[model samples]
Target: MPSNPYADLPAERSWRRAVVATPPFALDPTRPGDFRLSRTERIATAGSCFAQHVARVLRESGYTFYVAEPPRLAGSEAEDNFSARYGNIYTTRQLVQLFDRAFGAFTPRLTAWERPDGRFVDPFRPRMEPDGFASPEAVAAARDRHLAQVRTLFETLDTLVFTLGLTEGWRDRHDGAALPLAPGVVGGTWDPAEYGFVNAGVAEMVGDVTRFVDGLRGVNPRARVILTVSPVPLAMTYAERHVLVANAYSKAALRVVADEVAAARPDVFYFPSYEIVTAPTTVGRYFSENLRAVTPAGVAHVMRCFMAHAQEGDRAATAALDIRSEAMRTSQVICDEELLDA
Candidate 1:
């Protein structure tokens, strides 16, 4: 072939050499990232349901897996769930709004949602408290404590790995703040006028993510961000279009947003967890029977790809963690979105 820009590229640049010809388990698609995780770095995680996998693996592999808000109560559900008590943060808008709420820039008017049984759930985290809080006053108190922990997470963590889960979500009509789940699905009554559905476009996703990173660095000057689009598909979609079509657009748009943001920022980088599990080379081996849940094999493959590039060569912390035992616990991940499973 005639020499050209493409001709001179390495074998890894070719689709056939890099993917088609490689064995599924041997495949490693992660590029050289701008940063690597040392065992001492305070690592934190947030984002959609799939993010629970990232959090668990980070903890199991002997990394810092920083949790700013530990379970204050003896038998709290937040043990391996959230860095702060905020449940699944499914959109970039939710992530940005979280920072604003933490720093006192915004306060949502709908602080609590009343369940049918007369209990109230925190609007920010509807599924967090089982049976809901005793009163809105109790909800407010818990939130005050939660946001305080969130502020600490923002200021102290060295790196935050945020998994972008979806572009479709519900938001408040007045302030346009994102809500984790749709009203009535888990708790709260759905009113047409109170809440509005938002399907974020590429520009909106990029803007929100950029705003989040800017807000994060303002508090912690040295904070680094690792952006990854969750490979898991949406459990459901609110759009009139079929769930399949909406999911395709949502993932594609978010992937572009991640690429654009990571490329523009020096300290921010995009990891390819999305690419690894969703790769065609896997031949659908990465998904469970439902075609939505990621199989343990898939999660392990993603972790292997991450360790190959992002983690430092430290086996000391790995000594205490039983990888097989941890794998069994993957089924216990608390995904708020799964409430729509009916």
Candidate 2:
């Protein structure tokens, strides 16, 4: 029998001796450059706030990427808060729902606004100017039409990069749909029977992600996946008397999922953004006032390391064909505040 090459190696130094080094902010504990993003590849991002930053960076860097926001409705009072106005993809449930909608597995929901005159309002009209969609039926039909567009968007994506945020989330009891945020905060309402608390474990998360990847592949075989765990800690926790414990649980579960996915699937790659921020060796000067918001400097350093590593791998892959060339690249480092403004 062959002996394990690392069996006699010192456990402490094993990781350091390995070819890939772990970055500071990684929650998944994966080494850097495990997966390389090609310059020609199309990328799409979803998941937490950090995911938005990744999307923005890729876009600014002249990469092909998609950031899908909710559709803008005419005359909506809370238009700014609407999902359509933001590129956030909401909940993990929504991610799966997008795939289902694309493959014709489920129908989209339509909602209508009612006016005092017992008539339907026009959703497309400005709220100050007129009543919204005239009737419930009309509103419902309009919703379905909007959902079709969303379906098309998902179908067009070549690679979906998702950053896992929180393991604890609210879910619907009747159908097991996950809510993006607490119902009252956004447009959705909360109900006892309709909503339940879900703290996903490592297995459940892996299952959710695996199913999502498989479903997407079923429709688009060339579609690839990249997963990252959010470094931001939970603002609050539902666990009994221990918010810290809850945060640990959430991050640990997400890390496990990333590892399992990377081990099981060749197409599924794990990115170490979480480690890039959290590494003890890296300067803590990059955190915001809250200590959780990774600073702009930190993000730039992380992305710089990532881009450099990716470029190296690309060069190595093409070097054998004598097509490698040294090229100069320029980039701007923006702070978190600047990112917010952008």
Candidate 3:
């Protein structure tokens, strides 16, 4: 045998050479590339608020950021950032259930929830409609159209970049339908007897991810997925653990699930947005004053790493693109999770 297994490894294998010795700005965690992306491919994104950054990067880089679902009202920018009008999909359960709902395999009983002001909102997407629907029937009609668009998104999209966001969510006790927000956060009343909190363990998340990959392929076999864990920490937690502790478990569980799914198939791959932003090399400089929002510089660095691995040899990948201007271009990116703190 060799002098030691460690001695034969490259510089990347050494923590000091790979991370500590290198400047934080130069540290790139992404692999050469798991798959290739062309500007002509139809790319869709769905996940928590941080996923918006990925969509923004695609727009800035002149990629065909596909919007499978357009706004019902002309000139309305509500669905500007998301691929679909389903709003922010914060959990794997929500992701899988989305496919199920679109294909007519899963039907939820609790369709519309009444806001305190006598208007109804889709329980799965409470913050989507600020004024709420005129009636539950209107909500149902709108959801039917939304599901059809979601179907098109799954059927025609070439690539999907899904960011895993949360593990803790409230769900129906009877049928296990995933609720994007707790009942009372934005609308409806919190019924303890009817709904319950779920801090999904690793096994459950893995199963959810597997089903999502399998189900997406069922609709479009050529569809490849680029999974990433959102680096944004949880704003609040319903669990008994402290917010910091809860955030750690949530991120760790998601990272594990993304790796598990990505390892199983060549079509699914993991990106390191989580590692790049949260790396020790950065010394927490990526986060803003609140220690929550990722600074524009941090976002640009993440995009740089993304471009390097996406498809190489392009000057635009290394050249300084106007990231701030891109972010400002779609300043209307709406994140439903922000309502959780409200």
Candidate 4:
């Protein structure tokens, strides 16, 4: 054997790795600074399930993130109102389309039926509220209106946090546009060509995201982006006989896209929310109701991690300072209902 560097060398000085013991996975403890949320003066959110949770927590913690509130029908409960207003617009594709229409992605012209006089009208339910057109036509007009507002909206945002949820999506065969959901989920019958399966690869997803960010920057030069891969699995899969495999493929693709984009763009960053929830070390206690629902405890843990990071970024500043303080005060007043039963 060689001398082995004089047969003895002292151990290198390193912080002892603290194990974060929790359900779902254990994380080798990280310094708060290692995962700090950058100080974004303003923020916007879009994407799927995990995005909703992020928005909810940020709002509760007094962050000023832009969330579009839909019109509610009278006598509807909070959950019902949210469902009714947002059910049709859950995914990024849908949001992009919505904004495209608002920003005039397509030129809008009055249909033959929508003549000078209001007498002529769409025989079916009018898609546009102003006139009776098919849902498609209505969506087109709304998209134009949405585009008009995009410039103003983009100017106000400093950071846009988007959670990529699914790679497998349905597209209209005739025109080749992404459908918000399966045809039947919201309304309309499925046509084979009218809707076909599309499983986007990492390159395509990265291209789409880059284009979107670039377009937004064209309007607002100061905006930065934070991207995450949603940890939620598919509700259904187009891939034959293996939804789990499909989900794995989809998430892998999204993760690659996120990392690639972050690397390519100085203004872009990737958050590790997906890894925190799905890491194998924690033993999977984060899920609820047969691995679907993310438990309250899981959410709290995630929020704690997020807040700790955010706090480190700017120790003197807090989001929604007054509102968060008020909420804390209010929560203190409300006794734990669960403990009351005990």
CA RMSD, predictions in order: 2.1, 8.5, 1.8, 9.3
List the pairs of residues colliding in candidate 1. none
- Ranked by TM-score from best down, the candidates are 3, 1, 2, 4
Which TM-score value belongs to model 3? 0.95
TM-score of each: 0.94, 0.70, 0.95, 0.69
TM-score of 1: 0.94
Q: Evaluate model 2: give its TM-score.
A: 0.70
Q: Candidate 3's residue-wise lDDT over 1-342, tens digit each?
A: 769878878787789899999999999878775767898999999998778778867866778899988755544554566888888899999999999999999999898998888999999877767779999999999899989999999999999999999999989999999999998877878989999999999999999989988989988999999999989899889999899999999999999999999998768989899999999989999897878878777888888888777878766744645656645543465666667787
**Which ranges of candidate 2 are over 4 A from the true structure?**
1-33, 67-91, 107-146, 313-342
* Candidate 3 residue pairs that clash: none
Ranking by lDDT: 3, 1, 2, 4
lDDT head-to-head 3 vs 4, winner: 3
How many residue pairs collide in each prediction? 0, 26, 0, 19
Q: Lowest lDDT 10-mer window, candidate 2?
A: 321-330
Off by over 4 Å in 1: 72-79, 312-327
lDDT of 4 by residue, 284-309 (tens): 76676557445555555555566656
Name the lDDT value of residue 170 in candidate 3.
89
